[model samples]
Target: MPVHRRPPLPGVQRLARALALTAAATGVIHLGVAPAAATPADPPDRADVKAQVDQLYDEAEQASEKYNAAQEQQKRLQREAGILLTQVAAGQDDLNRLRADLGAVVAAQYRAQGLDPTLRLMLDNDPASYLAGARSLGQATARQNETLRDLRERQRRLDQRRQETAAKLDELEQARHRLAAAKDEVRTRLARARQLLGDLTAAERDRLAYDDDARAARGADRFDLGNEPPASDRAAAALNAAVSKIGSSYVYGSTGPSTFDCSGLMYWAWRQAGVTLPRTSQGQASAGRRVSLAEARPGDLVIFFKDRHHVGMYAGGGVVVHAPHPGARVRYESVSAMPVNSVVRV
Candidate 1:
């Protein structure tokens, strides 16, 4: 009971106490200190947001045209590959038959070997049979050689077709990817526009819509709708048909009696008039006679923008009926709304 442990060194005890206090102070600093305030970014104004949305929409249209072109190319490649595959299958069947025929000839020749000519003649019931066998021996040898050559050639052709098919398959996959990417871009841009609208008050949204409608109405009233008729009966019919679908919805890749895109509307309207237009605006742009805007008549295709991604049917006067874009119905608008690239008469 009298023996006690020696006390720690005074300096060591002081250092230990000091460390504990330092740690406690550090903990207090950590727990009490607030995080630094983050810098807040300014929200985009309505005009800036609208401008971005419009630019995105334009870019999306360009991408969509590229996607459509890729789709057309993919379809062509698929059809060509199908034809090549069919040809290759037929060639394979021919090659197989030729091989079987050559094998039969070899078997017959083997059976004929080591037999006397007189005995060979006696083995056959008819003299014609013996003569035919003799003739076949010579002909089969030549035919077998020819058949082998043909087989080799056919095989080579088949191989080439298979390679082409593989290449086409690869291209088709690439086209599909591109189409998906274009669709995504369009969807993303539209979604962002919607979000921007959501951020605005209901009154602001209504005002924006009202402004757009008023602007369009004012522009429509100012357009000089000439009393001149279409260039031809078909052109007149096409104009009437396009005008009838004034309220139809815009749908990408649709060439229909109902929903339509810019080029699809042209295609459908022209088809109604017994004229056939190409599947895309770019293709249709070059399908007919080029005409100046001064010479543009009703039913003439009014291609727009320097890229020529949009198309509309010229209505009488200075107006054009078109499926403007997604979320917009087919309607009459001034051609001056977009840069006039060219006019074409189909």
Candidate 2:
């Protein structure tokens, strides 16, 4: 049979030849890797992973701070609750005593046998004397009524205090429960690594555990923000900025005009005072000067641990300003929440 000619588009035939020639030089497999149709470069992917990892670290940092803040808030509420409850109890006691006294006075004078009217009237023979005796009786009645009114007022105050105490107690209990639940989640994750080792044989398990311990020991040398704050070109200003931020509400993941996440606030605060800081807590920790809290001053950075995380700025008066984390706003807290790990001078 004679060959039949087939029509080719203008550039099709040339393109086919070019691809074949290119494929022959490189491998046929690599022909699929056009300049446009290529996998992302390691740098870009790495940047993404790093970004994600940074975010995770930031999240963990925030969670830890939140746990600590909720802890502090709960304690404060509880303490106040206790004090209010005590006040309520005291008020009630006072009210009871007053009521008892009033009852005794009334019993003695207002009973059927009280106020010997016949004798009293007999003693008042003249009109002037009777009028004076009548005035005295009216005054006595008025005093008793006033005493009753005062006792009722105390009782009302006592009731109000009790209600306030109860409400605050409820809030404290709820916050405590929330913090406990968060801690439990952290505990569960920590245990997950150990559980993974269970699949190993006895000797293997022992070996893995040993390796794990060694790794942990090495990890201990890792940077802890617990040390002194990083020495800054403008240390005084950084400290002042942080101190000034106290009483602010804690905001998780915020760097703040209005709110701040734990690390975010640290980052932003320092920036405001003409200093630059790392975007993540770990990075910030690595950059500061480590000092003992006893030597701490108003501008020092205070760091804590529940795993070598959570940092704050000392605001003097035993209080610190920190972003606290999720479910909180940038605010002040007592340094007692976590024995400060280290104070940084930055």
Candidate 3:
């Protein structure tokens, strides 16, 4: 009786993979390396340190976002690799089957008293010199053909395996690096925050705590998006796609194949092209290259109102696509109509 063996559970494997990937990215993103270009031991002021820490936190968030993106890319690639491996296996099976059939044909041809083509030529030649040369050549050709076939098959498999291995290793290593970097970013920010706490006088600390409590009452992350989106190839692609959707109809909160509201249009376009964007219009407005109306590209999001009260996809030809109001379909209207604010290029 044969013992049954079960393959690993895909769900379990996927979960494990997710954890491993997260761990690796954390490790790579958070190196315990020395600080960037040491300065004099003036030991920065508490407020200054606090500001620096805040900046570092911003950096950390950026790094975390990047790690998340890389993680997704790595996962996608792994699935692709598996598919490629399956194709490689099928190729090998087909090759072996074909070789077996060819062997049978060759054997049957020789067994029926019909000469092996290779041997026939040898027998037809002069007994000494000609026959000897014919025999040597025939045997050499036969051996060479077999060797060539074997080598070709092996090479093909080897090439495919090498490509797959290289891709996996590269993605795995990248994920590991990102993990480390992200962790380090968080750790550094926490350290700086702690240092700021230490520098505070008792009364100042109390005041700070009071301010924190006051801010807490407001109930918001208060996260400032102080910088532009990192320069990336995806930014351009995303921007370009959004630009093309100018004047498309909108349905409030609807992602689209054709129509979209302000945020819905962005979400749908980015998600469709495999680039993730935030779900809400306000979130989408802050997610990319922040710019002024003068700098806005066709694909960039043109935000409106002082507090960013509205948004629209900047479709060129002096038009933008957006849901006009609460109970309306998204449609394209003049950029001039709305109070144009900041622009965000993905």
Candidate 4:
């Protein structure tokens, strides 16, 4: 059966439709905003990442040089301490011998106590014989006094050597502490750099490598290393040795035929040339006669930064070959690539 009902108003129907549409739109907006809110922030660009990584590597290199300096100092102190120990032992033996000799002289005098020199002189039948015996007694007294003086001098010298050894040991301990701290700093910085690099996408890392290669290429193309002779035969040899290590990986504090740090590379190269440079960049800065950048020749050490924590061997014509930093290989770059601190002719 059909029942009669009042008809709904057009405005009421339209209002109901509008409310339904509004609810659907709200749901759609919420669904769209949820994913947008969950998305992560964009990663840093290659240039920014490279700059940060470079800075970290630079800091790590500085710490590595400090570590090297401390290690060298520790080795020197150990050697010096060893020598001092030997000297002290020898001096002690000499003192003991001298004391034994003095004890023997005292014992002989005690055994002969009953024979006083004055009494013997009075009792002797020949006055000349008594006078000769008195002269012999005087000579014995002089020898005992000389032995005492020698013993005292040796004891003083032994004390001095002991003090020197103690000082050296103290210095060595301090150097060890410094070495540990520097090593930790280098590791921390390097770890941070690695983490940053790891955060980068594979494509981003590849791009960075490409950029580095391109930059190196550009630097090489611009720098003209003419056939300028090295300052000396040794210099030429050192330069050749450094150049031969191109593509070898850089490792913090390494001074080797395979891996090297900035100063380590210089040290190793100079060693190959029959010269020994200092183990740290700061030390190497003063290792030889200082020269102007314009006077720089092949095998000359080019120091970088005011702190002088970085070093490279000059390859002439405003180019240098260096171990750069960790995660990098030995390569040639323009001398002006970093701030030039000084030039040293070794």
Most TM-score-accurate candidate: 4
Against the hidden reference, what TM-scores do the models get? 0.78, 0.44, 0.41, 0.82
Error of 4 at 10 (Å): 64
> What tens-digit string does per-residue lDDT give for candidate 3 at 11-104?
3544566677666666766885433442344432445433444444334433334444455556767787677777767777766766676676
What RMSD value applies to candidate 3? 19.7
What TM-score quantifies how close candidate 1 is to the native fold?
0.78
Q: What is the per-residue lDDT of model 4 for residues 1-346, given as tens digits with 9 covering 90 to 100?
A: 0001212321354466667766777887888853223334446555556666787787898898889989999999899999999999999988888899899999987786578767877788998976876688689989999989888988998999999999989998999999999999999998988888888899999887776655434544567888789999999999999988877888987898899988888999999999988789999999999999988889899888888888898998888988888778788887777888999998
In every candidate, how many clashes are there? 2, 24, 21, 0
Cα displacement (angstroms), candidate 3, residue 260, comes to 25
Instruction: State the lDDT of candidate 1 residue by residue for 61-169, as single tens digits.
Output: 6665666677777788788778877877887888788788878877877887768878878886897978887887788789778988887888898788788778877
How many backbone clashes can be found in candidate 2?
24
Across 204-257, the per-residue lDDT of candidate 2 in tens digits comes to 656534543342233113322254443454665776666566445544435776
Question: Which portions of model 3 show Cα errors greater than 4 Å?
Answer: 1-46, 113-161, 198-342
Candidate 4, superposed: residue stretches over 4 Å from native: 1-41, 115-131, 210-223
Shift of residue 61 alpha carbon in model 2, Å:
3.2
Local distance difference test, each candidate? 0.75, 0.59, 0.56, 0.82
Instruction: Kindly give the stretch of ten consecutive residues in candidate 4 with the minimal lDDT sum.
Output: 1-10
Better of 1 and 3 by TM-score: 1
